[model samples]
Target: MSATPAYRRGMADKDFDFLHGRWRLRTRKLRDVMDPTCTDWIEFDSVSEIVPAFGGAGNVELTSLATEPPQEALTVRLYDAGEDLWRVWYLSTRAPGYMGPADEGRFADGRGTFVCEEELGGRLGLVRHQWTRLDTGRPRWEQAFSFDGGESWETNYVTEHEPLGE
Candidate 1:
């Protein structure tokens, strides 16, 4: 498919240890059909709790803020299944309006990428999020979108994770 190594899936557990904790996210604003240049940015504090289910696998629920409507209360969680190297699924309706359906993907070699595809008003679209571990002990999360097919992309958001209890 995407040239992912076979060994990658087997080592999911060993490589995901760095994700357990509290995180702060920073995302650059995205332009919409209404606004061409996104001059604002958003930030949030998130917490990830991992709990075991069965068969040596587990789940993670991440709670984050919704800056707009339902202000100070709306939140969304990203669900993860450990068996697939914590492949994530978006499971809440509280996120901002611009965000689309549940984007999903996995972690490998200290990197993670997830994407969501949507078709609205007769136009096809895609949203992708990626995470990469940096030498500073922080994982960087970035988001991009495409209108064509996977040929072009535009960065819409960015976040840096700092493990809790530091």
Candidate 2:
């Protein structure tokens, strides 16, 4: 049998190739997500593994956080060939049986940004996640929330990913 040719693939099929690997992440998060002036930030460690699926059109990510009680999260990313965008869904052990809101976006200029509507601290808000490749070829993820539409945003979490062996 002959193997499939890589060049024959479409743009939506390989957008997340950079995330396919094991990673160790250092996370810095604000203690209070709603309070922008809160300077109290907590640092933690986490690990993540991502693997391609759906014949390279999708991916699954498993992440574990080193919190006081220890938490685990999962994310599924699927690409829509027609729309040329990626849709993301997230879930966590902290809130069992409930999947978070869907976030949709595309990667551009080597960075990816996704946004969705969700409830944070009992208030409706817009949540955004950003992915960027660092100068060292590593990856970084940032999470922000906007309570008043998209006019203002407060960065709540930031994570830097380094390959497990590196």
Candidate 3:
């Protein structure tokens, strides 16, 4: 007999429902990703709007950052029904036609961990994005990179998401 919990066996398509609507995001990012000793951090604000698509199997998020020169980005998330996982892709105005690497994972116990391989300063690295605090009114997201094949990680970016008009 299978002992896996039903929730783990089949996650609902609405797993990302909490992310819908408008959010005000505060972000702190490392100024230099390659420098392990770099303590310089850049703080910025951004507004994000997310909407469901593909009959709940997909979602799209548009973000506009309040940086000095202003910045915009889009994230497309598609859920693979066959694998019961979600794949995320990012596109930023700074990088025009280039779509970043895909981060693929599934939410478990209200937390989501997505990982992908990326190139940081001409060196290969493993990137991880984690979503937590979903039960709280304000959810949090963090990004980390590991150069030693996941043996260690350096958190480079963090975003605090506050629901707008709440």
lDDT of each: 0.55, 0.87, 0.88
Q: Model 1's lDDT to the true fold?
A: 0.55
For model 2, how does the per-residue alpha-carbon lDDT over 1-166 read when each residue is reduced to its tens digit?
2333454347657878888889998999998878868999999999999999998899999999998889999999998766667899999998999998889987877789999999888899999999987445588999999988999988999999888864
For every candidate, C-alpha RMSD to the true structure in Å: 5.2, 5.0, 2.9
Off by over 4 Å in 3: 1-10
Lowest-scoring 10 consecutive residues by lDDT in candidate 1?
70-79
Scored by TM-score, the top model is 3
Which residue pairs collide in model 3, if any?
Answer: none
lDDT, residue 62, candidate 2? 98
Q: How many backbone clashes does candidate 1 have?
A: 0
**Clash statistics: count for each candidate:** 0, 0, 0
Q: How far does residue 143 in candidate 2 sit from its true spot (Å)?
A: 0.4
Sort order, lDDT high to low: 3, 2, 1
**In candidate 2, which residue ranges exceed 4 Å CA deviation?**
1-9, 134-136
TM-score of each: 0.63, 0.89, 0.91
User: Model 3: per-residue lDDT, tens digit, 27-110?
Assistant: 999888679999999999999999999877789999999987898999999887667778999999878999888999888878
